[model samples]
Target: MNILKSFFCAGLMSSTMAATSMVSGSAIAAEVKLRLLETTDIHVHLADYDYYRDKQSDKVGLAKVSSLLKTARSEAKNSMLFDNGDLIQGNPLGDYIAKEKGLKDGEVHPVYKAMNMLNYDAANIGNHEFNYGLDFLKKSIKGANFPYVLSNVYVLDGDKDPSNDKPLYDPYIIINKDVIAEDGSKHMVKVGVIGFTPPQIMQWDKANLEGKLRVEDIIDSANKYVPQMKEKGADIIVAIPHSSVSTSERKGMEENASAYLSKVEGIDAILFGHGHLVFPSKKYEGFPGADVAKGTLNGVPATMPGFWGSHLGVIDLTLSGETGNWKVSDGTGSVRGIYKRDGRKTIPLVEADAAINEAIKHEHEETIAYMRKGVGKTTAPINSYFALVADDPSIQIVTNAQKWYVQKLVNGSEYDGLPVLSAGAPFKAGGRGGPDYFTVVPAGEIALKNVADLYIYPNTLRVVKMTGSEVREWLEMSAGQFNQIKPGMDGEQALINTDFPSYNFDVIDGVTYKIDVSKPARYSKKGEKVSDGHRIVDMMFDGKPVDPKQEFVIATNNYRASGGGNFPGLKGDNIIISAPDENRTILANYIFDQKTINPSADKNWSFAPLSGKAKVSFTSSPSAKDVATSMGFETMGMAENGFAKYRIDLSK
Candidate 1:
């Protein structure tokens, strides 16, 4: 006998046996029971492991999620699984496919080959999907088993049918299924799922999408279509938006598509992604009739599972026959990992499907061979162990490479005399990213795969023209790296903001600067100047005060050039030159160009004088001990207190 609990806003009641017995006496007997399963932001880790580093990543990949999908289907009467995009262009495997295999017309892309095995009902386009040229995207989509949905992106062609000039995916897909009601009767549910990508893709990848296509605001597109979907006999509406809710200064406001689409009259549930965080459940007050926290949007249920195939979002709906609408009865969203790594042995919790695994086995094997192809040689072990506490050789090599690449370009151009500065941040600096995530290059043959591991993103090198004052403001934003200063002296504590994103703390290697956390920060991470006195003090170039009016050429990624870091005066008009080569590629070329390059930490950048200190603790995996100690910091004995603490003299 299977015992199931029936839930409603009123209360929960236990019932024995099948779902058909309870609804015999009701006036309206027919009811629909539909289950929606969603997977979002699976960044191309299809084989269940990170092939670039030759290890298993517990946080991402589809191997772990396969188990959750199996378990979810076993519990549901009628189910449909949908992927919410970002499937292409993230890991080293994605790079291997794009750069090596080269997707030509009629050829199947590796990501699509992996995704086709999953049998997704429908998928949305993510901003990262357009990172490669539009031609590549067109070829990849041709081989997909499912129809790609996009309501916002439009093709521009004169008078002719847009579909004729350019292939456009359908805006929405309506899936019809027979759902078993509690009373043993079957009801048909028309699930209309609409997909939207953020309109900001134009700004992020203007080179690929600007003149060829146009993206409208998310809200405007959803509003125009909700009525149409409803008119088309869609009983339940789900908006699969590849946009994230804002978590900045405004806490609960729905800044993205999920929040904005939930307010639309016909939307019943919202499946969200792109921010890469989990929102199991949330409530938006401004939207009427939608109570998302209770699993209901406008009285409908909504959920966003975490990214990287870590979790499968399950939303269960209880339909009302009298009103002809669905409401969230009860729901739960959770993360599922494939294997549990205790020590040397990894315990397998989920097994990969034989068919799916076997289908891509050849491609998987070839990808490994492609990544291991050697690029150059490294004289010393390059790692990011001390990246957070002090200057690190791993990041230094990247910045050094950027400076080398830009100096040649500047010398060839009219701006040869301008001072060139390299700005780079440590991506894997052992904070939220676990211990093994840190970049550790052995002193030997450095492969292209290893180079990719050091710089994970496919960001292009861009030169931005910034004044010394704007550069000062940019450094001030990075000053958020330190803990708040205390009033009186006399304290011994750690002096770091463990929660600060390591990527935002720009280490400008060519210039010398001291961050005075003793003074308030002049600018917030969002580029807002909160305090009058600048946190960056005594900024010097070649031991001389930097001229406020002097122009400088700064090397950074395309993301920063398009204002990804919220840095002041680094967006739009400030861009001087956009290099076609990726930043990591430039770094690789620089290493090869140098033949034998030695990267050393300058130690030019440091925190301001500490007035008072407080003991702050942080947690790191055991693997970071050796790297941490090499940077001149003492790691206290391990604490069963759930976090690791390192003692540092805050006083300058």
Candidate 2:
């Protein structure tokens, strides 16, 4: 029987016995006391507010989690508090400290300052730690109070010399904690903690970490080192992985370190992150026992808390003492949210530590002042609301800006006369992320910092040369953004896959063409062409089909140019020119060139046909209600799932 069922049955039997002995009231059963505490994917949200927008965000911030930690710790005698990586980056405070109040060599970062106040026992590194570079990472580590472990990432030792410049971190750490055994005897069990960062960092953050470090596959590293940890007197093994389990086959192919690592031997528990998902509660396809509530990883407890300090994961472990070693008998894991009041929309429950808050208070103020300083002006509102539906004003402005910048730089050159198609994705369309996440820029003075908020990614502009055929294939791959069209369907079928990652669906504004949902997609998510011909049927240049031999100049971010998504013909060799400036800068320059710019939805991009009405769900903040309704959908009443849902008519 399952743990909950067993507990229920025991209760029922006890009640029955009590009823039989009703003539004499019997003693009630004692409750088993065991507690665990955890915090995952804090992402350096130390304060209770969103420093970027200078507004309060109830969903995130370590200040809120601090209250949850204190209360949970108070509930148990033997409780272990842990953090599951991504502790660095995300907020303006982290950026300000790293870029502005530059780290003194060998000095601790402010994140470490706040983390130290929490007294975290162990922590794992997330991929974002490598975003700045290796030197910056090493300096940040110097400030950490706890050990950072990684089993997969290794520094390549030149000439295989042990004394030579070697890797920065140890593979795993064994933590010995005293606990009462099943027999009620006090004992010490050495819990082995191993950490792994996704190997895809070589591609994702190629600029910073490439050649300096080497990352082996997570499963390979786990199989290699887990036995060693066990041999070295570790009673239990826990994996702190900065990766998520794959939900769709499309997402599965994109490096999920946890799915493979969980199946490895000797691993007792797996603490996962990186795709920024909540787990044990939400199951993904291909993840073993993922559907099982509070499931065990290889018979050991496994969990992943939601990202950005919104939730804390706890695992209460029970162990048995045997000779010199200990083994896990059973355990339960749960995810808890941080809130001040019991009701929904309760203000952040926890208060920031006075010392930690004071430490970075000046840095915070300086960042605010810097962000408020205006760099330029915008005559119109630059919002990301309708970005996904059509040629969004925000994206259109960015594209126009990039095209203008490119045209000026290559004036009178051979590439200058070529027609340019600018591609941009909506960076801030609220989903999973709460209401405050949407990018809503007021019409007025525009600052460089605000530009950063507009384009959160550091992607640069690059021009790719592709034929008409390649362009159609590109759109077909993007068409995967919507659900597959069923047989004999009509009307506005729920447009593409809502979770297909807005970045992958390249919306080209300059060129106009109608998407035929009647046809099948030409390519798979990995860029493999499907057997069915092509879905992008009507490719036009000037009211006529594009010449198959003619080459078009496509402007896009460096990530897409370097084949970030498996889009065809956009990879390495197709590049015609690479701009040194970031896409956001190009966009800013474009807006400056065109004093008054107006962009609207082209209605060229739509999904395949639909059959019967199906409920399509996605996370959105309250602010997105108008935008969603404009796209033609029945807005479902709001639920407390941290996001709103809507029903779209699919039956034609």
Candidate 3:
């Protein structure tokens, strides 16, 4: 107790008081409402500009959210701001700062420079923070003016007891601060903040964090620390679990275990992210133990702000009773967005904080110039607006690049004679990311930005060896992106399942198959087998039925090869070559080498004709109308949130 007290007393300062001490015997007359503001999954969007499209966007960026911060803080009597994580690596600007111009000693990272200006109280370390490796992560966080707390992840020091293992960062921190009650009386309070990242980081970033670090389950870590914090004189405990909310039986180390974490004792408030969905919304209305109306999980106040700075989460707690016996009497949670849409018009709810944009102006300009450098020319237009509904040229070009690069590396190796296949998915098909998020590159000169738009993630190349039967299972898993359609039904059925992310809909280029949506999905969203339904029909390789026993090489990214998206039959052991170069870089190189390339879909895959009167419809960008018409589809008119609805007559 003395050691913990000494550490907090050494460097802690209250938000309102110059010098404050832990309240041992202070009395308060009335209740105090403390506002807890959170921004999660910022993903280094410091500016309100899209680096891929190279245009101004009013929908995203922390600069826009920063304006909401000032308003939110001004409305509350007492408040604290914290970021739930995913702060360092999402957009091209972040890539420029980390890869092009590296962070050095005495240099502040651009994201941190902007965040520091907002006066953040503290932050959590999200799972994406480990994508660039440990040294880079360490260097990036050093520039932050505020502290970081991560309770679950730790260094492997070969200790007999896990509790004694050294944490990669502070497990928790107790901030002693003075607060003003409604009666205008001042009282000191101890607020303990603890954070947890998903345990799957071990699998997601295995190459960078294999033997160096280990992560524990979120509930276990919270159980271990919350009691200790209370014993160490913490009046209120706030948990920032960077995982999402799930209402499932606690099986340990499960991703999206925030609901289970809420059942932990002594936690007053919860702020979670990583699912990139808003809390208290209709999305989780029937989820067990989750009160969508009250914005809580297991009756504890909680919220998850949308990703990429689209929204801000706020939790207000009414604290009552005396200083030593203070408790939360009432609690509420809500989210505020930076923009809203009415029909086709997007209305900006807040302006970008000019200070934040100014802080990173030089880096932002460099990133724009870096992306605008010409790489090659494209003979046909490329866009992802129709990628999910049909075979798309945008995805075809990426798979071609992957197969081209992988063939060169395995020419004389042990896997030379095996058939090579490439897997690619539409990353920007615009579900939760909004209508303008899809890729669109015109038929003309191509630049580095075009390649980046084609393949958004920073995943490195990896080749996995699998049998022909295993490939079938892989396709079946990817087929979960579609919902089962009934035959001979009336009215319209949704063609695309919004719950399944478009990035996980991997299409293998070397095989030809048709998706039968009338059949039920064989795998669940978590990649577990739920039924024996077969969706992939006429599975052919080399103009014949694929042999189940034949072996083949699959060119893919590290995330898929290492069990990301929970795909079937992947656990990192089957990888034949783990290339360190990013897929986007390989794509850029492939385009440059060709000088002039034709991006045309080979029509390798399509949906099997459905015999029914029911119309199949899907929503996409309003700009996709011309392409949809060219493919013999008709626009069904506008859908909600500015998305244009289109119908596909499957009987054709």
Model number with the top TM-score: 3
Q: Can you rank all candidates by TM-score, best first?
A: 3, 1, 2
- Cα RMSD (angstroms) for every candidate in the order listed: 6.2, 8.5, 6.8
**Model 3: per-residue Cα lDDT at residue 328:** 88
lDDT (tens digit, per residue) of candidate 2 on 151-270: 777676766653464545888988876654332334455778888887767766665665677777777778888999999998788888888775433332246757666668788777
User: Residue 206 in model 2: shift from native, Å?
Assistant: 1.6
Query: lDDT at 443 for candidate 1?
Result: 88
Across 492-558, the per-residue lDDT of candidate 1 in tens digits comes to 4345676467888888878888877667767766577788887788899989998998889999888
Model 1 stretches astray by more than 4 angstroms: 1-28, 57-59, 157-168, 247-257, 281-300, 322-348, 487-500, 614-619, 637-643
**Lowest lDDT block of 10, candidate 2:** 23-32
Q: Is candidate 1 or candidate 2 better by TM-score?
A: 1
For model 3 the local lDDT of residue 491 reads 81
Alpha-carbon runs more than 4 Å astray in model 3 = 1-25, 158-164
Candidate number with the higher TM-score (1 or 3):
3
Give the TM-scores of the predictions, in the order they appear.
Answer: 0.86, 0.83, 0.95
**Tens-digit lDDT track of model 3 for 480-563:** 888888868888889898989899999999999999988998898788899987898898999999999999999999889999
**Please, what is the whole-model Cα lDDT of each candidate in the order they appear?**
0.71, 0.68, 0.89
